[model samples]
Target chain A: MNRITLEQANAVIAGAFAKAREMALKPLGVAVLDAGGHLIAWQRQDGASTGRLQLAVGKASGALFLGISSRKIGDMAGERPTFLASLAPIAPGGVVPAAGGVIVVDANGHAIGAVGISGDLSDKDEACTLAGIAAAGLTAQA
Target chain B: MNRITLEQANAVIAGAFAKAREMALKPLGVAVLDAGGHLIAWQRQDGASTGRLQLAVGKASGALFLGISSRKIGDMAGERPTFLASLAPIAPGGVVPAAGGVIVVDANGHAIGAVGISGDLSDKDEACTLAGIAAAGLTAQA
Candidate 1:
């Protein structure tokens, strides 16, 4: 299984920041997680909220846990709010049912890692995450 | 029940690390937990991953919960994945169905505490944990 190196994790953070700057999004928090949902890297920009890191981790780890993007989780939450609520308490990092979380996949579509961004609009946060993964020359699960 | 003192907890960490170094293993994270599974002490060697601490705690706490080493929990997980996964949410620290968690016991075989190690193969991690417990003059649950 492909693992995200520290260097790649850093690069993903840098690329996310670049996209956030290009879009003039609010200060953001970014997190990269390994296939096992362990943190590989994390960063919170100036002015980002104190819980930004947790939020970002929740997004990324949740995506990895369910093998789906957090956006899809959001939809599921909408359809089954109780189910999502039940999961939040159980997930160690957390399960934030929102957008901005994307799984990084390998050539065979196996999840190698994940990236999550927060602080801006959810869609905008997701855009930066996508940009970051692309910048790292990695593929995001479709 | 006798509690593992701070000094002994630290010694466990030191001994585990010494064994790790002697074996040329990767950097590790270790956690010593009291009988109630509260952390008495923890340390992460340089180069260990960010979530190593949590993983270590999960192992130790899981051992305390089930009254067995995490290796046994791992075997249980293999036999009943859903059962283990269901427990992960309710177990506060966590129930990482893996090795590297060993319960420290008294002469009468009553649990006093647990030691957990991460950042290497499960068996290797368990080996260091055992060595640490021995160095601290503690008996592992038989």
Candidate 2:
């Protein structure tokens, strides 16, 4: 199994921040997690909320838990409110059930890691996450 | 119910890691908990992620919480997701509805302790847990 190295994790964070700056998005918190749902790296921009890291981790870890992007989880949440609500408690980092969480996949389409961003509109956060993955020369699971 | 001694707990961890090395499995985090759901011993192999210890403990403690293996909880989660999710917050250390947790039993069939492993596939982790128990001359609850 391919593991996301710390260097790649840091690169993902830098890339996400760069994208956030380009879009003038709110100061963001970003988290990178390995496939086991363990945090590999995290960063919170100045002025971001104190809970931003938690939210970021929740998004990323939740994506790993369900094997889907947080955007999809958001859609699922909309369709099955009760089911999504139940997942938050059981999930290690608590499920945010929102966009901004994206999975990074290897050549085999197996998830290697995930990236999550918070502190802006969910769509904007997701855009940064994608940009970050691209910056790291990794593929985002569609 | 008999209590698991510290010495036995250490043996369990050593034995589990031995089996893990033999099988060339990924780095692992193992936790042993007494019947009261309190930690007796814990070890996280080099290269394992930071949150691994928490996950290891969650699996064992969760088993004690429900009086069954975490594998059974995983199956229950599949059948009744809401029911399993509801138990997480109330349970100490949280509940990880996954395999890798096994209850240790005494000759009288009384619960003695539990072993939890993480940092690999659920089945592989559970296999190590069982091996650890056996190495300590304990039986896994059927």
Candidate 3:
């Protein structure tokens, strides 16, 4: 299995921050998780709020845990709020069915990891996350 | 002041896992914290218990918050049980006051971060945490 590497994680984080800067978004926190749902790398911009890190981690790991984009999960969560709420406790990182999370696919089309962005509009966060994965030469399931 | 980088944290984790493998210790969980006591990195080896991650985080944060090794905290806790019991609620990460947490120091003798290990004997966990810091060419205040 191809696990996400630290260099790749760094590239993703740098790309996300660059996009955030270009878009004039607030200071963002980004987290990357390996295929096994373990944290590969994470960062918080100097002025980012305290909870952004955990939010990013939760989003990314939620995506990884579900093997789908968190946007899709959000839609599902909307339809089944009670079930989703119950599911959070059983999930490793706990679920946050939101738009900022995307699954990263490797060359073989395997879900290799996930990238999550926080501290901006959900759509903008998703854009930055996808851009980061693309910047690392990977594809995003967003 | 030098802040602990993701690269250094990765090195430390890798070194700790390598030592754990070398020593044939049980599956372990390790966590790294920044100078401000925020989580920087963490991993639970395959088959490690669910609680190990939180345990590692608490121990590391406890050490960082107190500016001393968790082993020392444990000793103090033994003597001042009531004080240590009261301290946990005041600490952000909820102090563990046990072995397996060590502060990482920079060349100028400033505390940079901390490493905490769990899922092994407390003494062995402390040994691995110190070994990981040393392997990364960082000093462990153990």
Candidate 4:
């Protein structure tokens, strides 16, 4: 299976944070996970709350576990909030079911992992992650 | 400057776990970092406890920041626990000042990164990490 490298993850973080800066968004927290849902890299801006880290990680985990962008998960949750709420108890890494989580895909179209960002409007966060993923020469399954 | 590749990091993990198994140690969590102290990879065995991940990363971070084996820092920490305790609040990635963290050295003798393992005794963890580093044809400063 294709895997996201640390260099790639670092590039993603740099690109995302750069966009966050240019857009004047709040301090952000970002996380990258491998295909197995294990953390590969994470960064929290100096002013970002510690909770942002967990939230970012949760979003990525939710995306990987559901095999879809977290925006989709969030939309699904809108119709069945209770059913989706139950997933956290059983889902790997406790799914967040929110926007800002995107799947990273390899050249062959395999989902390699995910990139998640926190500390902005959920849509804006998703946009930032896309920018980062693109910077790393990867595609986001949005 | 030679950077550790994801392939090398995966090889390190495989080597480390193989050593753990040969010695019949408990399930382990292992982490690798780049020279900049950014996480490169991490893994927690199926039966490992949740906290192992953080502990492993913490140990690696402590070693990377201090430019010394965590075993040496642990020894110093024992002599000054209160002073060592103060470091976490200000240190990068929060210091763990314990054994099981070793710096990965490149051919030029530069500290390229670090590897940390948690699960068994600290000494045993350190030994396993060293074995893994050797298997990857790298040296561990421990």
Evaluated against the true structure, the overall lDDT of model 1 is 0.86
Local distance difference test scores for all models? 0.86, 0.84, 0.82, 0.82
lDDT for B37 (candidate 3): 85
Which residue pairs in candidate 3 have backbone atoms (N, alpha carbon, C) closer than 3 angstroms, thus clashing? none
Root-mean-square deviation of each candidate, in angstroms?
9.6, 6.3, 5.3, 9.5
Each candidate's DockQ score against the native complex? 0.04, 0.09, 0.18, 0.09
The second chain of candidate 2 has a TM-score of 0.96
**Candidate 4, superposed: residue stretches over 4 Å from native:** A1-58, A61-69, A73-142
Model 2 off-target regions past 4 Å? A1-17, A21-54, A60-116, A119-142
Model 2 per-residue lDDT tens digits across residues A1-142: 3889999999999999999999999899999998888889998988999989888988888887666788998997886564455455546786788899998888877778889999999999999999999998889998
lDDT of 4 by residue, A26-118 (tens): 988888887777776666665555477678888999889989988898999999899888886798677787788899988787888899888
Question: What is the C-alpha lDDT profile of model 2 across B25-138, one tens digit per residue?
Answer: 977999999888888899887656445666677788888888999889877776887787677569867677778999998889889889999888789999899999989878
What TM-score would each prediction reach against the true structure? 0.59, 0.67, 0.68, 0.59
Query: Candidate 3 or 4, higher TM-score?
Result: 3
Q: What is the interface RMSD of each candidate, in Å?
A: 8.2, 6.0, 4.5, 7.9
Model 4's lDDT to the true fold?
A: 0.82
Q: After superposition, how far is residue B105 of candidate 2 from its true place, in Å?
A: 0.9
True contacts kept of each: 0.02, 0.08, 0.09, 0.06
When summed lDDT is taken over every stretch of 10 residues in candidate 2 chain B, the lowest stretch is B46-55
